[model samples]
Target: MRSFFDPRQLAHAPSREFHNGGWSAYAEVPARAEAILAAIGGTERPADHGETPIARVHAAAYLDYLKTAPARWLADGREGDVIGYTWPAVRRRPLRLDRIDALAGWYSIDAATPLTADSWTSAYWSVQSGLSALDAVLAGDRAAFALCRPPGHHAGADYCGGYCHLNTAAIVAQAARDGGVARVAILDIDYHHGNGTQDIFWTRGDVFYASIHADPATDYPFYWGHADEAGEGEGAGTTLNLPLAQGTTLAPFRAAQARALDAIAAFGVEIVVVSFGADTWEGDPISAFRLRTPDYAILAGDIAARGLPCVVLMEGGYAVSALGANVASFLDGF
Candidate 1:
């Protein structure tokens, strides 16, 4: 299996994040990527696919904000990472706002994602890594992995949140469709639900999105990911969400995976995009799943047994010390 990783992804490190009504050290850090790289051995630097693929999923205004927010914050005589403190509750209307704070609020979904000077650079490269992996799969590789940090799955077409700035999985899926793949399926196995990914493809039938994550009723990103959110418009019945309870073990988790895989098979997709996250490991610091390191291999092997080309994109997993082993085990299955 070919794997891609860009060193520039580590440059987007932020000092801290706001969680549970308090400020704390950021759970998503550069060390997370380093650990994975150390375990995985060598990785190729991703080729630059430019901004066209990213723009296919993310909004132009949001991309501009990500690129310029840090400079704008500095120009306002502010220091540290730029974080949004206020957010609009109603529909946003056009307005002339020059303040960086206002722009932050306008473009952000929550305060967990902070914008640093190199965040845009890192995020841009992160997308390239996923695109590079997709390139490998499209070229006839059975599977490929993209080690993306500042893990994306929470960022939508126009907003950043959940320590995610850009929806890399969504972008790759769209790119697959644009590259002539008739049907694509995104299977997100992160501990947390991929709300942004679902939102981006909510009304599209070409790419089916499925996720098995902690129940939103008691976990992060508590709005989407319920079982009832099947899809809307042309995308109806294309989305499958299986919300597991906290402290879920492998038996039930495997059941959920079976259901998701069965649906994807039924959809008859030509390719499968696995939004793989090691946070579901039992030792993960910020997650609730109780899956052990060995369990990942078994779970991933199940997906591999489906005999489909796979493009695996890294997402959330904060147990720094155990992360590498968990990831390696997962890859071993494929």
Candidate 2:
């Protein structure tokens, strides 16, 4: 299978993240991509598809904030990477805020995702990697992988969080629609729910979103990813959330994947965009799933059984040591 990645993806290196009411080393680091590349052998650098394709899913203002916020923060005498402390949780009214702190809070969902100077560049190329992988699938490859770093699944149209700046899966699905795919389904097998991807297509019927992740009641991004939050209006029944328990094992995880695949088949999707995350590994530090390394092949083989063309975009997986083998196992299975 052809794979796409950019060296620039390593540039969005944030120093640390605020987690559990304390500051800690950033879990999402450039070494994550380095480990995957070393295991995957070679990858093609993606061409710059520019902001047009990204604009299909993300808001222009949000994009602008990601691009300029670093410079604005530095100009305002702020030190280190930009992290937001406040958010408009009450009545998020539309208003113009020029302060870097306010803009950071306005455009961010949490304090975990810090914005560095090269964040926009890396995030831009991350989307381009997915687009190029989609190009391969459109050109008749059975499947392709986008080794996107600074994993992007938790980002919404207007906010960035969960170590994600751009919603790569959402952008890729929208791009597939623009490329003439009649129906598309996104299967996010990440440890955490893809709240951003679900939010992006919640009211749209063109793309179907499905995810199997840790139950939001006890996991990160605790507000979204419930069983009852189905799509509304034209996208009704197009969204599926199969939130598993915290120490979930392969048997139940595999069953959830089968149900997600069956739902995709029923939706008549022509292509599947997998938001693959190896963080579900039993040894992962931040995540709490019990999936072992070999189990990835079994899970991936289930997706392969469907026979639909797939464009797999990288998502979260912080166990740097085992990330390579886990990713390799999934690709080998597919």
Candidate 3:
């Protein structure tokens, strides 16, 4: 499998993230990409597809805020990392905000993702990595891997959260749709629910999304990801959420994976984009699943055996020591 990555993804390293009632060293770090790259062997920097592909999925206003918020915050003489302090409690969205501070809060969904000076550049390249992998698969490669940093499964079309600035998986899925794939299914196996991808394709039937993750009742993003959220309008029955209980084991995890795969197959999707995350491992610092290193191979083999062109995009994984082996094992099995 050809892997796409960019070392520049290390530029927007966040020092801290709000967790467990206080701030702690961010779980998402630059070392993540480094470890994955080391284990995965040679990788090519993604071709520069620019912001257009990202804009296909994310809102322009959100992109503008993400791109300029860090520089504007520093220019205003703020201290430490640029983090959102408050978020609107109601569902009524704010139309516009001119102040940088208010804009930060308006565009952000939580305090976990902090913007640094290089955030935009890093996020830009992350999107490029996913896009380039999509390009490779479209160009006839059976499978490709995109090692995206600042994992993107959490960020919504208009909000950034959980260390994700742009929804890279959604971007790739959207790019696949635009590239003439009639039905594209995104399989997000991240530990957390891909609420952002769900939100983006909530009303569209063309792109199907299936995520197997910790139930929202006990997970980080405390909303969405419920089994009943089976899409809205035209997308009804297209979005599938297989939410697992906390401390889930490999047996049930595989069962849930089988169900998700069955649903994707029923959808008759032409391509599958997997939002792969190693955080589901038992030793991961931030998640509660008990998938072992070998379990990843089982998962990857199942996906590969489906006989479909696949694009695996990196999502979240923080067990730094074993992260490399987990990623390498999955690709090797694939």
Candidate 4:
């Protein structure tokens, strides 16, 4: 597998996060992509160093905002990273809000996704990483991996949340379609349902998105992730949601993959994107799932057996010390 990455991933470190009742360091690490790729023994590639730039998919206005928002925030008297404070912009209304802060909330779906002065640069690089992995498979790589950090899967076309800034998995799948595949599938195995991904592809039938996560009723993003939500418009019946109960074990997770695999098969895809998150493991600090380390390799091998070009995009894993090991083992298995 090929690993795609950019150096800017190190820029968006959160000073603190809510963990175990109090705030601890946000686990987005600088060395993760490189270390995980090295442990997996894969070829390394600089992200988005070619003719096609990485910012193409994002809205031009939002792209401009990300580029300048931090400076603007600083100019507005904020001293630290600007957390998207409140979302004032609603799709149905146009002339109701005018403040930039309001626009920030409007554009940002939730408070969890904050922006450092360097956030745009970091998110841009993350997108580059995803695009690079997509390009690798498009360039005929049998399979590839994007060792991107600041895990995205939570960010949608217009909303960012859940510690995610750019919906990397969706970008990769979209890139694959742009690169030539007619039918593409995204199998998100993150502990959280890929709300942004699901939302982005909810109305597009050409791309199928399936997620296995802790049920939203009992998990984060409680508003979405219900099995009954299915898909809308052309995407009806195209999206599959397998929301497992909390404390689900490895066997059940493995069993759940069958449903996802069935969805992938039904899509008749030539390319696949796997949103990989170690949070599902028993050791994760923020989650309650019970997957063990050994289960990772089996997961990798199982996905590898699908016989399509696959790109595994890193999502979330907060067990800092063991994080690299779990991810390394998965790629080694892949």
Give lDDT per model, in order.
Answer: 0.94, 0.94, 0.90, 0.78
What TM-score do all the candidates reach, one by one? 0.98, 0.99, 0.98, 0.92
List, residue by residue over 140-257, the lDDT tens digit for candidate 4. 8877787777788988776677887777787777777776789999998989888888998899999989899999988887877889878999999889999999999988998998
Candidate no. 1 TM-score: 0.98
Best by TM-score: 2
Task: Give the TM-score (vs. native) of candidate 3.
Answer: 0.98
Report the C-alpha lDDT of model 2 over 148-238, residue by residue, as the tens digit: 9878899999999999999999999999999899999999999999999999999988899999999999999999999998899999999
Candidate 2 to truth, TM:
0.99
Ranking by lDDT: 2, 1, 3, 4
lDDT tens string, model 1, 1-334? 8999999999988999999899999999999999999999999999999999999999898898899889989999999999999888864577766789988998888999999999999989999999999999999999999998878899999999998999999999999999999999999999999999999999998999999999999998998999999999999999999999999999999999999999999999999999999999888888888999999999989999999999999999999999999999999999
Q: Which residues of candidate 3, in runs, are more than 4 Å off?
A: none
Error of 4 at 19 (Å): 7.3
